[model samples]
Target: MQLASNKGLTARNDNPLFWSLRNAFVRGDTNGLDRELRYSFQSFLLRNKFSKSVTASHKKLADLRYPYDWFPATRAMQRTIHLHVGPTNSGKTYHALKALENAETGIYAGPLRLLAHEVFARFTAKGKPCALITGEEQRIPEGTDRYFASCTVEMAPLNKRVDVAVIDEIQMIADQERGWAWTQAVLGLQARELHLCGEERAVDIIKAMCARMGDKCIVHTYKRLNPLRTMQESLQGDFRKLEKGDCVVSFTRIGLHTLKAGIEKITGRRCAVVYGSLPPETRAQQAALFNDPNNDYDFIVASDAIGMGLNLEIKRVIFEAVTKYDGGGHRVLTVPEVRQIGGRAGRYRTAAQDIKDNHTDTTSRPTSKNAPAGMPASAGLVTTLDDEDLGVVQAAFTSEAEPIKAAGILPPTFIIEQFYSYFSEDTPLSFVLARMREMAKLSEEFQMCSIVPLMEVADLIQEFPMSIQDRLIFLTAPANFHGTGQKQVLKVLARCISENRTAHLLDIEGLDLDILDIERGAADVNNTQYLQRLEELHKSITLYLWLSYRYQGVLTSQHLAFHVKSLVEEKIKDFLDNLSFTVEGRKAKRQQTRLLVERHRKLEEKILGDEPSNEAELVQEGPGAWSEEGHEEALMEDEAEAEDPVGLPDAIREVVSDDRLPRPAGEDVRT
Candidate 1:
């Protein structure tokens, strides 16, 4: 029998723990054996204890109503919650935020990064020390005392005790995708005053949940400040009448691009586009362009992304299609979505610019007034191309919004694994989350959201033999999947993690650290695919910042990461803004963003000033080649696959896909 030299088995043999265990067996001394057993036992015991506590918690939950308050973070705290409820632009959040601003120590958690950033910028500019903590970036200034913190809801600090905690878009607690973050924030935040801000739909459910948790809840309802009314007449796809304050809505990326390009080409007016895929920097810039009355970017093309948080002065919102792909299938826009996006058409204008004229409400529906109830308005209109769905839009005002039940949840990665271990080997990842849900019912700490993403990448991690820590890093990495080459970027990160180190730009082979190295992505951005690469690099910089925040001591290169982030942001902005500019001109003016043109030129001259006349200052180039680390390893494995292919141990192979291993000549690759 020919014995195969298995790669996985070889790795297993070389592991330090494996050697320790082997030594215990070989040595006749009982102490050595006992030492190794204790290490293993301790690890298992820690995990097992967590499992038991969660299981017991679930059993007891059946007898109690307050499943959320059991968490140690919230145990001593009898939360005093103030519910600021109203429609969009009703000043609910604005007033709630005023309360947050007055508090000595506070946390403002918003559903979107843009919203958190707005709060961060507003607070910081007001000279009130503020720290911005999103998933990928941390902007905490030095020498600031008791700084206010603004963060994405998922990044909300559970342990921190604040004078006030503000949760924006509280209606999202009913959202199947992100509800858990709102839920966790509401349940875990130990604030003296917890402020929930959103529409009236979430009011009852929030009150009920707070009541059950034994917290005091109060409701503060407000009327919209501006008059927002749907148009009496629909556009019906008439491109001839496209005007300056018109925002055309599309559902998908292709739709946004096509509509934008076509509208700009026909109307000869620059169109500012806003979609979910655009980086937050680009989105803000585009919005600024559209908002400026003096600018030629009069027309706005956007997705549902423009519906929330963006206070735009859009005179009309034209829906291209009422139906959109909601992951599974194409479906009509929900009543909430229709109303929300339509409301943006007639935005609350500034105090100086008054619209004291008659309301612009067009439809004959009793509620069809451009002005909201009890609020005076000017001209604001919402229309659609397809008249068949006009009735749906018309009926949106009276549609009863759904009540939020339990919040969605995603337990920490290790907890996910522990719960996963209990299920049979043949069980799918779907069941892992299903099991998590059943388990969370028993404990506050274990509350898990549907966690579809956890399932999506589970197989990808399983493909490689990785440590639990490595698996967790990959799973939690906030890398964008499409267009961006984040998958390749992730591979680089995985290799560094496997080697037990953090990656820096210096270690990335081709990356240059010189401040004036704008040529790094200068050439590539010309190609269509370069945008994706640039996006990936941008995301990679964020990944570094994220890791630095997590393990600050081990990954002490956050400063370098921030510098790179600025460079990449400049490159991306230049590429998007100056599509018509010559490559050389674009490169020369790339650093002109952020109002630093003269300063950038002076810095460039200074760096080159000390160098020889013939030499450029920061032109240290890579060998001008791109290489992926795993390619060589895969090639070597391919050679082995033809002869003595290695396979994983049955223990792991039973649960994980054996697809990573080479298949036999007659065997199906997938199976």
Candidate 2:
């Protein structure tokens, strides 16, 4: 029987039935494995003509254990994958977009409404069906496979299935108030695959958390596209000497305006302006004017807002100040902020390409005679924020609850996760909970009369959740302390917030030491003035803190009552102070003060009234010379006119401009 079995096994190995069985095993077909194995044995007996020896071999095969019985074959299947880590320029969004191009359905989630519009246009250009969903606008397409848009992540519906979801600027997950929204989006997104993009530090934390949650996380790091071209020497003398295409980056609105005026005065060339206060449409228009290839504008005077979104064709970036008021005090720019603004210079591809060609042909070409001063080495300068004592004061005004989650908007799980992200082992969850309890007690004791409604306040606190409320409390509590050395600091904050007044209250020379003392807790205090200042500062701080916690819904007049009172007190005090003189002096002061008082009263009334003022006034007047007749003709002189196609190097300038370039066959022209 043994000899017969060996012969049968050898014969079966060469049979077609046995070959089919083996193929089934290799392909990981479980049902096919069992069926084919049985068939192979039976077929072998029949093919060998069923002799006594073959029959005996079949009997022995039946007695022997089959490989299928020991191990079952299983197929490998594709699983949805998510990537959630990267810095600003790391191409995290780029990678996700690439995937979206191939996916049956995909969505690109952006943080801002403007960003959503930009992405929607980008995806639409790519010949993909896209939609925009922002708080201001929602445009959903019927039966669309992909969504290129922006929405408050917390408010976005999760029921819709997507093949892949890309969440841009995921670091917003740590935002004090709105962090909950991002956190919810990260946790609740139902896409088969998820992708997150943002700064490296924030991404690292997110990636770690995702790993802990059993989701696959991948990280991509990218250096800034344009690094600062550090100068061997600093720029000296007047800023008017700054060549065309230079960007003058100032910290303050006044500084930006002054720099623009100074540049125009010296160069006799009009400068374009871009800053935060300007509308998005205006900012875009200004950026375009500065970046125009026709070179219409000579210089751009801008604030830090220029550091984001719109691309400017800048050759050099000049810093008017290195530090900015961050709503608390003067603080130095963070590494990321500095890098962002500096990166704007030398980013103009057309300009950079030309510069590179000029450098390469310096020895061999005549064009090297005038290459525009080598484009100012693509460098930037840094300046210090003048008064450091005001940094904390500035922070106090701006320090409000970040609106991590809009009330009634985010999921419970997301709110919980957001709270968890803030605590390390050092700070216990119980401490945070305790703070929330204290806040609750305060709210109950100082509850506004029911005439206005208590439900609104309760709803506001409920909307923020305990974690967010406690965080705001902690952030603003430091400014509420009293002491002799802290008198000036407390008074400055109180005056600034209560009156909406920003003046040079502290000496610039002593600012650094004062700031250090406050931060170090080394300042001493025991005066009534200091205590009174602290009390006033505390009220302002508390108002901001409460507003931050309850700012999700439509704002009510009661909510703004304290702010109005503060403004009124500030105006009244100014009026009284200005009238402390002779009768004639007092009368003149009174007239001026009365006009201001009336304006303030009108503003207050407008705030309370259904109709708010929407007045538009010219921010800056053109020069008297420009206002005269032939100004346009004079300004048009020395203009490059039209770009000389032949003047541009062959390698740098294509026969057709990028806009007119012919598309490759089979490539999507929409994109």
Candidate 3:
């Protein structure tokens, strides 16, 4: 009672509940004390209502409903938006890029690094001063000050003003995992003319956004140059009937290699394989081999990586299955996926080819828009390997995809930092992220992106004594914890950061030149541990490169990391070239699933205790506590979704632009 009085605790409206309760207690009035306690409880509840309890800072951080307002410069501009809406192989991107090519100053933001690389190559070949920027690398041409910039969407410059900007694959605004990048680009890019190229499905949503911005919107509809037709009959799982120009699509890396082997065995022609896990350069090489008419490579075995506008000289698309395992479980392919992948079958005159031909034609030879000069256009054909998948493919092509309703957004680092300031210094980063998610305020037009991956990273680096800003940097790194060697590499880097020591390429354990040396190739690619190690090593090097750009001095071996990355990629390519694996239907899947379950069981056992397990502590205490060796089976089956490629945050952007080292929080903002 005395303590309560000192703290100015009292009842409302002269009720004197605290005093009454004290009086009751002193007089031994049990009923009065109970009544006073109930009244006091009600008073406390009324006083500490949700609205009253929430601080102004908490409300400010949670109110992410108006993302447009975040970019004041972009919002101030009255921009012109050109919506180039069409299906694949429709030359939609061609017209948009043409405008960009002619512009004095421009930027082309694409979804994939491959696309950015392609644009950079095209512009460089044309002798245009262009710069390429992606999460992994940046290549700036000599004697240029941003005349043209080709970058992954996340890396698009929001602060710099450009005359024209092209945001390719605008339909990705609805993508669950990476939609926020597209959204950020669309909402934040400072451009006089913005070209948005994508499917017709994104038209309304984009128009709605433009209307909200009070910008003039122009829609340009495009038709495919080559007609696409769904075949009436399936291949009936017959590899012998597969044609030379056919592209067989499968979901898994193992499945891709198995299909390649099976197709080669029956057809007696070399098959080039492409999948997501493979490096982009390797995939491009495989595509080039399949495209070259003089080469013995005829058929191409690929994953959905081809769906992302990978221009291959494919005559027909044969779907091995209409479903894929998306982290959680098997789900039917969406209309957009089916359309995008199937659309790659026969690109009569791709944007790149068109640009090349036009540039080389010194005699000014005129060519038809639909087909190149003296070349007959081929129609794209779609079919299924098995009889049951045909209907699914047909239905997906004919049906319309649902219109995108909302754009994905993440709580910016500054907002996160503001929220973190309210918590104790000892509070776990994961706890702060969880609380933010719980208290998030979103409107119907916007949705918060999944921060589960961030939470996982936070948990991994929880024991490290690092600043909030440094921790955010790691959390945003392109490290999927479940990836084969990613967790191991991340742990090493985190320890170095915590200890304020520079991390060298040699500091990483179990990764050496001997490990990456693939003299020949694996006999069995499907279940081989060596091939898995190479892939893991490739990812590890890529992660290092990504970190190198952000923590320049801290991760000091960018040159060595790039060299090792190339070596790993070459080894992987060699492995693919010599692989001759035979797999029955879904045999590899079962094997991998079992292995993943067992490994996960073991991980659970290690972490299951009175308190949460410190992953960093485990790494320091145990040699291979988190090392994912011989778990190629788990690597093959239970790969987590790719982490969101974080772009240059406002603070990081300033440091990068200035070409200086990171400064203190007072001097420079948090990343």
Among all candidates shown, the one with the greatest lDDT: 3
In candidate 2, residue 306 scores what lDDT?
45
Instruction: Write the residue-wise lDDT of candidate 2 on 147-235 in tens digits.
Output: 54444343355556677777766654553224545555665566667776665546544654454345666666655433344343334
- 1 against 2, candidate with superior lDDT: 1
Rank candidates by lDDT, best first.
3, 1, 2
Taking the tens digit of each residue's C-alpha lDDT, what string does model 3 give over 1-671? 45344654432212344434644332222333454465445445533334544656576787877777778899999999999998887778878988898888899998766677778877877888999887778887786676789997878988889999999888877654567778899999999999999989788879888887788999999887767889899987778877767898876665676678778887788999865445556766877787777778978987775676667778889888776554433345777888888998776544355565774221233222223223444667899987767998999888987777767678878788988887678877876775665556666666665555677788788888999999999877777543447787888888887887899998776454566544553354333556556666766787788888888878899998988887876766565555454434333343333333333334334433234221101001000111221101122433221111123234433443442335654331111
Clashing residue pair totals per candidate (backbone < 3 A): 9, 25, 0
lDDT of each structure? Answer: 0.57, 0.40, 0.68
lDDT of 1 by residue, 79-157 (tens): 8999998776566776787789789999999866666776786776567898988776778879866778999787888
- Off-target runs (Cα >4 Å) in candidate 2 are 1-93, 101-104, 125-127, 139-146, 152-159, 175-178, 224-227, 232-237, 251-262, 275-281, 348-671
Distance (Å) between predicted and true CA of 258, model 1?
4.8
Distance from true location, Cα of 602 in model 1, Å: 63
Give the winner by lDDT: 1 or 3: 3
